[model samples]
Target: MYERARYWFDNTLARGVTALIGWLAVACLAVVIPVSALLVWTDERAPDTAWAKTAAVWRSVGQTLRLGGEVGSPLRVILSVLLALMALFYVSTIVGLITTAITEELIALRRGHSTVLESGHTVLLGWSDQIFTVVAELVAANANQPRSAIAILADRDVTEMEEELRSEVGDTGRTRVICRNGRPTDPAALTRVSPATADVVLVLPRDHPQEDAEIVKNLLALRTAVDDSRVRTVAVVRDAHCRLAAELAAGPDAVVLEIDDVTARLVAQCVRQPGLSVVYQELLDFAGDEFYVVDAPDQAGRVFAEVLRACPTSSVVGVAGMDGTLRLNPPATSVLSQGDRLVVIAQDDDTTVTTHEPAAFDESVMANRPPAAARPERVLLLGWNRRARHIVRHLSGHVAAGSVLHVVAHGSESLAAEVRAAAQAAPALTVTFGPGDPTLPGTVNEVDLSAHDGVIVLGPDHGPGQASPDDRTLVTLLLLRDRERTSGVPVRVVTEMTDDRNRVLAPAGAGADFIVSGKLVGLLMAQISQNWHLAALFGELLAPQGNAIHLKPAGDYVRPGHRASFATIVEAASRRGECALGYRTRGIARAGNDHEVRINPAKAEVRYWGADDEVIVMAER
Candidate 1:
C-alpha cells in the first residue's frame, strides 16, 4: 500500500506542476473579462472619482490582458492542447517499440545464435569468384550426405550474399547454405561461422594482388582463433613463394595449393602442344575419364605397358614400383615384378579391370635411334621480369657447363644484381648483360640469334602504370623475325604471355612457341569446378617426382610421310619407355590461325625431327 501510494504521489506531483502552469494562464484571463464589462457600463462618465477610477482600472486591465491574452477561450483551447499532447505520446511509444525490436535482432545476429548452424558443415572464409566455384563443388561433393551444410563468412549483408549464391550456384544438391556477416581477417568475426565445428575450412584468395599473403595472415589469425586442427584446411595461393609461408601459417596438416606456378606450368605445356588443355580436361574433369589409383595383381613376368591395357575404361599411363619409383609410360617388355602398383587412368576406380592391346611392337627400329643433342649450350634471355629468374633457376639443373645466357633489356642496370644472384648458385649459367630497348632498334642485332641455341622471351612484369606485356612481346617478335631473314640457323624460342587474348599479336613466321598464362588459369578453374581431387594430381605431375612431360626427337615416334595415326605415335612412345599423346608436325603452313599450326607438305614437310618440336610424352628411365 505504501509503494502504491508513493507511485501515485510522484505521478500527481508531475501532473500538478503542469496544472499549476495552466491555472496561472487561466487566472490572467479573469481580469480581461471584468475590464471589458466595465468599459461597456461606463461609457458616460468623465472626471468624477468613480468614473476616473473605473477608467484607470479598465486601462490597466486592458494592458494586462493584451500582454498575457492566451486565456479567454480557456475550455476549447485546453481541450485541443490536451488532445495534441496525447497524439504525440502515442506516436513516440510506437517509434520506441519499433527501434527496440530492431536493436534486439541486430544483437542476436552479433551473438551468432540467430544463424549458427549445426556441426559437420563446410565453412568458407573470404570472398571471390573462386568462392562460387568452391561452393558449387562442395554441393556436388555433399550429394551423398544429406543435411550437409555450407557456411560462408564475408563482410557483406547476409541477404545479399544469399541472393548471389542462389543466382550463381543454382540448386545446391542436398546442401543447405548459411551466411554470416563478418570480416574474415578478424578472429572474433571468424567465430560467427563456427570454424571449430566445421568439417572443411577453405581459405580463399582476396580479389587483388598480394591475395595469397593476405590469406596467409588470415590463416595465422585462424590458427590462434580456431582451436581445432582436425579440420582439413585448403587454401588457394596466388604466388609460388607464398606456398611455404601459407603451409606454416595453416600448420602441417593443412593443404596449401600454389595455383599460379601450376597455371604457369600448364601454360608451358599447352604452348608446347595445342589441344593439350583438352587432354588435361578429359583427365581431370568428373564428367570425363578421371585419374584413379588401383593395385595390380603380382605378376613376376608381366610388363608395365601390357598392364595398362588390362583395365576397363582405364589406360595404364604409369607404374609405381615396389621401391616407390613412379614410372609413367615405362619401357615396353620391361618385366613388372610383384608389389608394383600400376598408376592407371580411368573414368573412375570401378573401371580398372578391362583388357586391351598394349602396343604393336617392332624392336629393330626402336634400337637404332641416335641420342639427343647435348644440353642447351648458349641461350638468350630477351627481357627482364619476375618469371625470368624462375626460368633461369629451372634451367640451371638442365643446362650443362660452358652454357652462356645473355640478358637483354632496358632495365639491366637495376635488375643485373638480382639476375647475378639467381645465377650465383649455378656457375654453368653465366650472365652477360646488354642494355637496349625492347620495342626499338638494334636490340636483336646486339644478341646474335644464330649464335644461341635457344631464346627465351620473358614477359613484362605487371606493375602500376606499365604498358601491356603483349605489346612488348609483339614488338620483340617482329624484330627477331626480321633478324632471322639471312641466317636459317635454328633458334628455339619460348615466350611468356600475360593475356591469352593478345597471343595472336605475335608473328607466326618467327618459329616461336608461347605460354598463355590466362588460358591455363581459366582451364584450371573450369576443371576444378567439376572435380576437387585434380588439384593434387596435377600438383604431383608438375613437381619433380617421377615421369614429367619432355620434348623428344620426332623420328623416335614417327617418320616422314609415314601416314602415322595418333595411335601409332602412342605405340612408339610405349616402345621408347615414354607415353606420347600428341606432336608438333612441321611442313604445315600456319596460315591466319593462332590456335593451330598448319603443317603444309610443300614448304617443309619433313619428319618433325627438331629440338623445337616437343613430343608430348611421359618420360621414364
Candidate 2:
C-alpha cells in the first residue's frame, strides 16, 4: 500500500510539471491560501483566548487538514513541511513548462516552421542538387545590389539546407538565404515564404519519376496564392509532353522549360559543331556574358543591321517588338520601332549601350563565298541512357538525308526497340545498334573508330538506386582516347556527363566536347529565375523547330586569306538572313575557353579569315 502511494505521488508530481497555467495557479493557491489560514487560526493571542482555545485548535486542525499550511502544536509543524514541499513543487513545475516551451520553439525553428518576412526576395521552391548552382548564380547576379535575399521553400529541415548551402556555395556577399520547410504544393506552405511579394519564384523540378506532375501541381499552388500579376514564376518540366500542361496550369505568363528537349537539342548542336557548348555557356552562365533586353530609344528609327554595328561592346543579336514579340536574328532591313527593346549579349546589362560613332566597315575585304553543301556522314554512339532517344531524334533532323548512325551499348531488346522507334520517326537518318560493354577497351575496339565521321559518348546508367552516372562515362572516354591514340585516327568526340565535376577529369588531348547535363540545366534555370522573359528566348533558341545557334563556314561570309572587319562580316551574314555574333577559329575548339571564340567583338577590329574558320550565327539551318 505504501509503495502504491509513493508511485501515485511521483506520477502526480510529473503530471504537475507539465500542467497548464490554470492548473499551476490552482496549485499555488492551494498552498498559499491554506498556509495563510492555518497561520491565522493558530495565533495564540485570541479575542477569547481562554474559552475559545479549544475552538481555535479545532479550526486550525480543520484548516491544516483541508490545505497544507503552518499551525500551532506538532500537527501544525507537519502541515507546514507539507505546505513548503507543495510550494517547491509548484515552482519546479512552472520552470519545467517554460523550459519545455523554449525547447519546442527552438525545434520548430530548426524544422523551418517559422514564417519569412522579406520583400523583393527571390523565392526558390523545391530542393535538389541544383539548388547550390542556383544560389551561387543568384549571388553573383545580385552582387551590385545593396541587399538581397533568397528564400527557399522545400520539404526539408532548415538547418540541413542551410548547412549544405553554406558548404557548397560558400560566401554569398550581401545576399541572405532563408529556408522554410513545407510542401511546395500546399497553399498554406507557400504563404509562409511570402510568394506574393517576391521578385521571382523559381520552381526546381524534383529528381523523381513524377517530377513533371509535381512541378505542375506546385505551379498551380503558387499561382493561386500569388494573385499579384507582377510576380514571375519559372518552372522546369522533365518531359516535353508535360510542358503544355504545366504552362496551362502556371498561367499564360509563367515560364516552363522542357529539360529533355533542351538537353537533346544542345547535344545535337554540340556534336555537329565542336565548342558550340562553350558559346552557349558564355551566354547562359552568370560568370560570363549573358543576354539582356534593353530599350534603345536613340536608335529607334535605325535598321536592325545598323544597330548590330552601333553597339561596339555589345552584340545586338535580336529585337523585342513593342507588341511583346521576340525576334532573334531578324532581317537587316527590319527597322527598330519606338519602344522596341534590343536583345543584346554583353558582360553586364550596363555594358549593352549604343555608340553614337559607328565603326568603319572595310568594304574592300568583303567577299561572297557560297555556303557549303550538305554531305552525308557516318556517326557512332557509345552507350545509351534516358537522353539517348531524344539525341537520336534531334540528330536525324540535323544530319544529311543519307547519314548513317551506329549505337553500341550493353542492353537487352527493350532499348533496341526504343532506338528503332526513334529511327522510324526520322526516316532521313539510318540507325543500327550493336550489343557490347562500351566501358571495356576490347568491346570498343570491335568497331572501326576511324570509319565514323563523329563519335558521341552518351552517359550510361550508373546502377540501380545509384547517384553518380558519370563514372562509366569517364571510363568509356578514357578507353576511346586510348583507341584513338593507338589507331592514330582523329574523330570529333562529343561526350555527355551527368556531373560537371567530372568534366575536368576527361582525358587530355582527347578534344572531346563534354556536355554536363545537370550544369547546363542549372544554368538555364538560373538564367530564367533572374529574368522570366528569357525563358521564351531560351525556348526558341534551343527548340529544334526554331532559329538555333549555328557555326557556318567563314568562307560563306568572306573570301579565304582576306582581312575583313567584323562590321562587314555582320552585313554579309545579314544578307544571308542570319545574325552573326562572333567567329570560331579553326584548330581551336577548347571547351570553356572563350578566347578562341570571340563573342561581341569590336566592329572596327580586322581579322584574316580562313576557309575552315566558322562564323557563329543564329539561324534556322
Candidate 3:
C-alpha cells in the first residue's frame, strides 16, 4: 500500500510544470501552517478567544505566503488575500518573461545568428585543413594594419570553430577571428557575415567527392547575398573540368585556382630544379617576402634593365602594363611607362623604395664560367595519380631532347593514352608505362634508382581500403630513403602529399622535395584574394612558355672560396639575362634545416660563396 502511494506521488510529480507548481504550493503550505500554529499556541500574550487565535493563525499563514495578513471580518480579510494573490501572480509572470527573454537571446548568440557590422573585413566560408594556413597567412598579411578582422562562416558548431581556431591561430594581435555556424549554400545565412561589405571573400573547398559542386553552390549563394561587385572573391577547385563552372558562378571578377594544375606544375618544376619548392614556399607565404604589385609613379619612363638596379631592398621580377599586359622577366629594353605597375618581390608594400645611389659590389669575385650542357634526363616515376599525366606533360616542356620517362605504378597501363599524348606533344620525351606497386616488397629496388636522373612519388589518387593515400605515400617515401642510405647515392625525389602534417615523417634529403597540396593552394588563394593582379603574375611564373624560377650553382655567377656582395651576384645574373633574387647557403640540405632559401636580401649583404651553394634566379633554363 505504501509503495503504491509513493509511485502515485512520483508519477504526479513527473507530470511537468503544473504538477511541480502544485507540489511547490503544497510544500510551502505544509511548512507555513505547522509553524504558524505552533507560534500561536506557544505565545505568552494570547488573544484570549478561540476564534481570535484561529484568525491569528490564518493571518500568520497569509503573511508567510506573502498574501495580505489582516485581523478583521471574514469578508474584508478574504478580499485582501485575493488582491495579494493577484499581485503575486503579476510579479511572477514579469520575472519569468524577463528570464526567458534573456535566455533566448543568449541561445541565439551561441547559435551564431547575429549579424556582423564591420566593414573591410575578410570572410572565409567553408571549413577545411587549409583554413589554418590561410588564416595564419591572412593574419601575417594584416599585421601592419592597426585593426582588422577575419570572419568565418561554415556549417559547424560556433564554439567548436572558435576553440579550434584559437588553438591553431594564437595571438592574432589586433585582428579578430569571428565564427558563425550555417550552411555556406544558404543565401539567408550568408547575411550573418555581411559579405556585401566584406573587403574580400574566400570560398574554401571541402575534402569530399562533391567538393566542386559545393564550391559552385557557395558562389551562387554569395552572388545572391552580395550585390556589391567590387568585393574580391577567390575560390579553389581541385578538378580542371569544374574550373569553368566555378568561374562562371563566381562571376567574371573572381579568381579561381585549379589544384591539379598548380600541384602538377609545382611537382614538375621541383623535380627539375631541387630546392625550388622552398623558394616558392618563401614567395607564397606572407610571413616572408612575397610577390607584390605596387605603383611607382616617380620612376616612370625607365627601361626594365635600369629598373632592376633601382630598388636596393626589393627585387623587380615583372611589370604589369596599364593595358592589362603582364610581362615577367621582360626584355631589358622594355620600358615602364606612366600608369604601369611594377611587380616586385619584397617584404612589404611600403618598403619597395628605390634609391639613387648605385649598389656596391666586388666585381673581382664574379665566376664568369660557361653554362653547363643540357643533357637528356632519364626520370623514373614511382607512382601515378590524377595529377600524374599533367605532371608528365609539364615535365616534357622542361626536359631536353631524347629524355626518357618510365612510369611504374600499380595500374600504369591505364594511363597509356595520357603518356602517349604527352610524349607526342613534346616529341623529345619518350614515355613508357608498366604495372608495379610501390608499397610491395622489393618493388622499389627492382626499379633501379641509379638509372634515373630524378624520381617523382605521387600518392594514391583515391583511398580503396583501410590505409589512406598519405599512408601509402609515406610507405613509398620510407623505401626511397632507405635505398638512398644503402646505395649512398643522392636521388632527386619530389613527393606529393595530401596532408601537410605527414611532411614531418618523410625523410628530408637535400634533394628530397615535398609539395603539400592543401597548404600551398591555400597560400596561393590567400595571396590572390589580397591582390587580384597576382593571379596573372603567378600564372606567368608557373606557365611553361615563359621564364620560371630556377636554382643554379652559385659558381655559375660567383667564384667559390670568397665572400661576395649580393650586388655582384645581381650584376652577374643581369649579364646572363636573368634576375638574381636570392641564394641558398651551402650545407643546409640535411634533415630539420629548412632555412636554405632566402629571397630579396639587401644588395649590400655579403655571403661566403661556395660552388655548391645555389643562386636562386628567374631564368629560362
TM accuracy, model 2: 0.83
Candidate 2, position 454, lDDT: 80
lDDT of 1 by residue, 1-621 (tens): 999998876776578768666656677767665766576457565445755555455445545544321233567545645665576568879999999999998877754435465687778888766666567655654566757887888877777788899998799878888888877788888887778787767787654455667888778878877776565677777677788888888986466766556654554344333445535544443444555556776444687555544443345666666765565566677777777766655645555664444434343333236656666477777888766665666555556677787878777456878777868866657877777776675777767777776676766776656777778888887777676765665456667776655667676353456665544443444343233344444556766455565555566665533444344455567766676544544444455422332110111122324433435566741
The C-alpha stretches of model 3 lying farther than 4 A from their native spots are: 1-10, 26-84, 411-427, 462-468, 589-591
How does each model score on lDDT?
A: 0.62, 0.81, 0.85
TM-score of structure candidate 1: 0.62
Model 2, which residues run further than 4 Å from truth? 1-95, 227-230, 461-464, 508-510, 586-595, 608-612
* Candidate 1 lDDT score at position 337: 75
- How does residue 65 of candidate 2 score in lDDT? 43
* Model 2 accuracy (lDDT, Cα): 0.81
| Candidate 2 lDDT tens digits, 1-621 | 999998876766677555555566677668755665566556767546543554454455545444443456777767766786687679889999999999999999888878889989999999877788889999999998999999999998888899999999999999999999999999889998999888888888766435678998998898888875557778887777788889888886678877767777788788888878878877878887888888889998888878888887777788888788888888888888889999888888788778776666766666766776889978899888877888888888889888998999888899889889888887889999898989888888899987888888887654547867677888887888787788888667888876677889887343457777677878888888777657778878887677888888888888889999888888788878888888888665456332377787777778889877889988876
What TM-score does candidate 3 get on C-alpha atoms?
A: 0.88
- Candidate 3's displacement at residue 399, Å, is 1.3
**By lDDT, highest first, what's the ranking?**
3, 2, 1
For residue 198, model 2's alpha carbon misses the true position, in angstroms, by: 1.5
TM-score of each: 0.62, 0.83, 0.88
Between candidates 1 and 2, the one scoring higher on TM-score is: 2
